[model samples]
Target: MNNYNTIVIGGGPAGLACAVKLHKNNVSCLIIEREQYLGGILKQCIHDGFGLQRFKEKLSGPEYAERFVNEVFELNIPFIVNAFVVSIEKKDGYTINVSTVEGIKTYTCENLVLATGCRERTSKQVEIHGSRPKGVYTAGAVQHLVNVDGVIPCKKCVILGSGDIGLIMARRLTLEGVKVEAVYEIMPNPSGLKRNIYQCLVDYDIPLYLSHTVKRTIGYPNLEAVEVMEVDEKLKPIEGTEKIIECDCLIVSVGLIPENELAGRIGVLSDARAKGARCDLDFETNVEHVYTCGNATHVNDLVDYVSESGEVVADAIRDRNDSERKLIDIEVKGRCAYLVPEMIDVNKKNNKRVMYFRSNKILKNATVTMKVDDKEILRRVYANLRPPEMERIVVDYPELSENSKVVFEIEEAK
Candidate 1:
């Protein structure tokens, strides 16, 4: 049996960030990773684009992860690789039963952080009617094979979603001399960032078929073709709009769902909209001393945002005993899909609070208005808004009164 002040699950960017912050605060912690390596999904993301905001320099995914890994090493944070946490149960007031390889280990900690990250929504989840054939893969799996394992999955491919991973894969495969037949997106607008659309698809001349879907897949023992169809506004297949594209591989990047089985096992309250834990402003879950961040809380597109989430969780844990905490509810409405840190408890002494959220639909030239008890507090406009891309807003404690209800909405500017 091992014990620690804090236990962080998964060695991804979020977990590493949480562990690093705890270490800096002179707190002892342990990180448990299922894989032998600590980098997580970032290891397979070899393309440069990460670290623009966090490091102020563009770096490959591996490079960004290496920077953090170095910090973990320098701090001498203890981590167990290839150790999967099968279950977590709150034992007493401060001890948790963490089932792992060496055996069922009881970890007594002041805080617990869940950074298990997210998993790709697979073709099975989408229920695509087709013969199960070779060469079909999730975008992340293909990324690992190509970028980490250094092997191409196929020569010709068609991506089934316009999410960031699928769009990036289209460009990646194209760069590797593979033919990307097309990227089919059922939504009217691309699910990924506008910048990815311009850089990865438009620049590479890869066609993006919007309001379209794969009606059926055709292949023998191996994937040979796909039947794509244009859809009406209702998303029903239009007659006579079927087109066949020959491809040996099909990559699906439909969406991501938070990996929260462990959190759920311990009966943590979760948000219906975000499919993650319902957290207070301090990133603490309904269970005291247990915190969650990164994709496990909500799917964030940028690694920097994940790191920021980690810092928030750490700060909350560090200040858990503060007596001036007041719980406040943040209501997200009007075209917004979901918001993170679903509830906020203003620490009057701390002076500042941050909120993260995303819109449900695409908006152009719009201003996001936030109000506390019918008084406008903050507003910001963006050239565009999409659900997959997260938007962060910061608010000061003084701007909101104790026990105040904060409301956030988005509207287009004339």
Candidate 2:
């Protein structure tokens, strides 16, 4: 049995960032990753446009993740690669079961940080009714095939959903002599960042069909074509609007959901919208000292935010004391899709909150107001709002008592 002060489960941007921060703070921690190497999904994402916020310069995913991985190596942070955490039981502290090459091992830690990241939504999740064909691939898998494996998954493909991965793959496949028939989006608006829409889709002259979906896939041992159709507001296909597009492959990049099986093992509460653990301001989930960050908390558009969330969890763990936490729930309303950190721990000295939110529908000239006990704390304004682009803001407010209620509402500018 190996014991440590803290256990960080994951070695991607989030997990690596937490280990780096903990090492810098002279804290004893162990990083456990299931993969053979560190730098999770980033190792395969060869495209640029990462680290724009954190580094203030454009970098590839590998380059961005490399910075943190290097820091972990330089500090000689203790980590186990190819280590799968099989079980977690919270006793006096936490007893974690691991399955490594050396066989079963149990590790004990006072605190656990889950930066498990997220999993991409697949064809079945989107209900793509079709035979399991060889030509169907997820955007991430196709990216790995082309960038890392030196093989192209498809020569001519039709991409479903305009998320960043799908958008980037559209350009990548096109550049590799693959013809992208068009991008089909069920929602009225594209789900990816606006910049990707221009640089990846419009720049390549690839067509984008909004309020549309892949009605059916035509393939057998391989994908022959796909039936695209317009969808109504409820996202159901319209009658007689079906059209066939000949393509060898169909790439799906609908969305991502947080991976929280380990958290579930600990009986941690989850937020419905966030699709991950519901954490407080200190990044501490309802499971006491157990913390969560990165995409395991919520799917973030930028990897920079993922790294930041990890660092936040590191600080939270280091300063964790026996003080009682009094939490106040935050109310979301007025067309807001969802808000991270659903509640505030008013008992803690930390008052600065980094909030991330998105609107339920598109809004122009919108205003977001935050108040505690009907007392205004902060107000932010935006010229344009879209569901694809999440809004992040730092809000500092007066410390409150246990009964003080916090509310966040979005509204059109009067």
Best by TM-score: 2
lDDT of 2 by residue, 154-269 (tens): 77899999999999999999999999999999999999999999999999999999999997888898999899899999988999998999989999999988999989978898
Best by lDDT: 2
User: Which ten-residue region of model 1 has the weakest summed lDDT?
Assistant: 344-353
Error of 2 at 257 (Å): 0.3
The lDDT of each candidate is 0.84, 0.89
TM-score of each: 0.94, 0.97
C-alpha RMSD for every candidate: 2.2, 1.3
Model 2 spans with C-alpha error above 4 angstroms: none
